[model samples]
Target: MTSSSKGSYTRLCIQVNLDKPLINTVKVGRLKQKVMYEGISFLCFYCGRLGHK
Candidate 1:
């Protein structure tokens, strides 16, 4: 099997359209990033972004 390119991975972002009907076979994911200041970092569960929760 062949592997997909790394550029395609970041470009392929998923989003749900509320205006359309909900589909059963769809996949979902979360966006996240860690914030660091002077060697200190924070973590979050909801949405996973630092301090966004």
Candidate 2:
């Protein structure tokens, strides 16, 4: 497969709605951990940085 296509499959993007109430810190932390455990890269929507859980 081409690099662009491969990159899309490997990366995981999660878009959180800003209109919703803020998620609890503990819950957010757990979510990140869960995503990491799944072996997919997480990208931060706000800062545009990769999340390291």
Give lDDT for model 2: 0.41
Highest-lDDT candidate: 2
Task: Write down the lDDT of every candidate, Cα atoms only.
Answer: 0.37, 0.41
Candidate 2 residue lDDT tens string, 1-53: 66666332234456655445323233444453222323336644344345542
Q: Which 10 successive residues of model 1 have the least lDDT summed?
A: 31-40
TM-score for each model: 0.21, 0.20
Candidate 2 structure, TM-score to reference: 0.20
Every candidate's CA RMSD: 11.4, 12.1
Residue 36 Cα positional deviation in candidate 1, in Å, after optimal superposition = 32
Index of the highest-TM-score prediction: 1
